[model samples]
Target: MKNNRLYAQFSTGYRAPQTTELFRLQAGQTIAELDAENINSIELGLRGQVESLFYDVTLFSMHKDNFIFQDTNRQNISNGETSHRGIELAINYQWQYFYVAANGTFAKHRYDTNLTLSRINIQDNEIDTAPEHIGSVQLGLRSDLGEFVELEWVHQGNCYINPENSSEYSGHNLLNLRTGIRLSERLDIGIRVSNLTDEDYAERDDFGFGSYRYFVGEPRTVYATVQYQY
Candidate 1:
């Protein structure tokens, strides 16, 4: 047997348009009822070491759909769902006083609005933060000086940002760095720096004729951490 509940909410200052599919001054009201039961997740992968290097790889896929959204202005109530199919890779290597690790993700996301939504190809962006390409790499070493540390890095560029490729937004290559020392095998400390060059970027772009000014992610940040694991 299955049971379900339904609810509707209007914001303190939100009102939906009267009888509309989309494209109104006021967002539309949504009536939603769902049925769910017995859901679970599973992963499959392999791990092994070759010579002096270690490798782990995973291929996985998941899908979701059946959702709805209504804007306060009622002109942008759009609903859609998409899926992600991709692989995760990891590799580690060690050489006298030097260590390196690398990882990456290759995935594809596709979304279609339930009501043929459109605005610079936003109907396709509904998948939410699903980048077509993603990757990262890291390197570290205990310098011969025992104090001077050099960091190196590289990663794949994000391929998708906001449904369409050319919609006032572009993908970017992110960089990171970190270095520190080990007070002891039981306790170690380090710092990580991101966006080394301080590039101006946005994960989401707003284009509504200056109704409001939006903010994106951070420009740069440095953090230090000390930890002990049993």
Candidate 2:
């Protein structure tokens, strides 16, 4: 492993179906029985610092059974099964007063079985909110005088909006700027301006009530903060 660290891990997880999801009777539909979902996962990772650069990489896979999800018909269902596999990477470097940091993830989350929904068998479809790619990069200036300024770019790849894979939320990218200064050993101040480009986007999207709707993402905004450490 030299100057790096390598590790492997296995874990199990469980989640009970939400009470509201299970008992919220809609119209004339009867409440259906639901079961807790379970997952088994394995992960392998390597982390280390090489000179001024620091990096960590990880690969992971998970198998989930009786996965609970909301259906297109607005009913909660425990589908057959699903699998998720992914890789994540992070790196940071500093050269004098200038530095950069970046991280990214690429993954696939898909059905591992033919799930019967509304008299249809759907298999190998991507899940909602599970984009195939997501990443962020930040470049900054820092000094011994306790001052720093940074700009960051964030990105998300296109993702399906429902289990039927009928629609997509065509991804988005955002820019943000931040700066801070230390007034004293125990006092500091900072300002952040997010969505620097004022791009229009949506945090979530879905088809409901025979129409498409979205929760609009936040627009360009600014704020300041002050901190006093005891």
Candidate 3:
């Protein structure tokens, strides 16, 4: 699914705790009022498939009067943001013995931030880790070993940080294996492994960026399970 140049406008109001003393957020804080207004937004989408296995995509967008950064402690700063235009895609195939799939994301998200402070005003540009392009694929094969077994590979494209767009982040290629057996009537057992290759990669940047950056990913591991039903 996709969207384009859609705008959202809204207003909200709130009341602070009634206090005998002036509303004190910090030792020396200064905020205007408890009401907000004129917040705006927009979006766009482009996607399609080919031969029922291949795919294509694109995304364009812009927004104004948005404020996710106003959560700062300044108490007197209001900011708005927007996103850069981009695209993404994927492909896949499946057979009795072998199956594969691939996909990617391409987008440049940015925002304008401003703070209202006396002699300490601030404004800046922030580039998104969405990256102008993102891509990855997966391949899997099935086999017999007294039971049905399978192993698969997965990979992703790189990401980024900072408005200047530097230090292109690295992606991780992961592999997994699984096997199962019929233990008895309505009973089954299975074994599996994650991150089979144990490839070292950072799913996110040290600082907040893109979706869930700054979060460390997991390493390789193994597990076993059994299930019974009547």
Q: Estimate each model's TM-score.
A: 0.60, 0.89, 0.58
Give Cα-based local distance difference scores for all models.
0.54, 0.87, 0.53
Model 2 accuracy (lDDT, Cα): 0.87
What residue runs in model 1 are displaced by over 4 Å at the alpha carbon? 1-30, 34-44, 71-79, 112-116, 119-128, 143-156, 159-168, 182-192, 203-214, 220-230
**What's the alpha carbon RMSD for model 3?**
7.6
Cα lDDT over the full model 1? 0.54
203: Cα error in model 3, Å: 3.8
Checking candidate 3 for backbone clashes, the offending pairs are 2-45, 3-44, 3-45, 4-44, 6-42, 127-163
Query: Stretches of candidate 3 above 4 Å error?
Result: 1-27, 30-64, 70-76, 112-135, 142-157, 162-168, 178-185, 208-215
Residue 171, model 1: Cα distance from true site in angstroms: 2.0
| Residue 10, model 2: Cα distance from true site in angstroms | 1.0
Can you rank all candidates by TM-score, best first?
Answer: 2, 1, 3
Worst 10 residues of 1 by lDDT: 1-10
Worst 10 residues of 2 by lDDT: 113-122
Tens digits of per-residue lDDT for model 2 on 1-230? 57799989999999998888688855655875678899999999999999999999999999999877655566677866999999999999999999999999999998887775424556888876689999999999998987999999999889987667888999999999999999999999999999999999988787657667888989999999999999
Candidate No. with top TM-score: 2
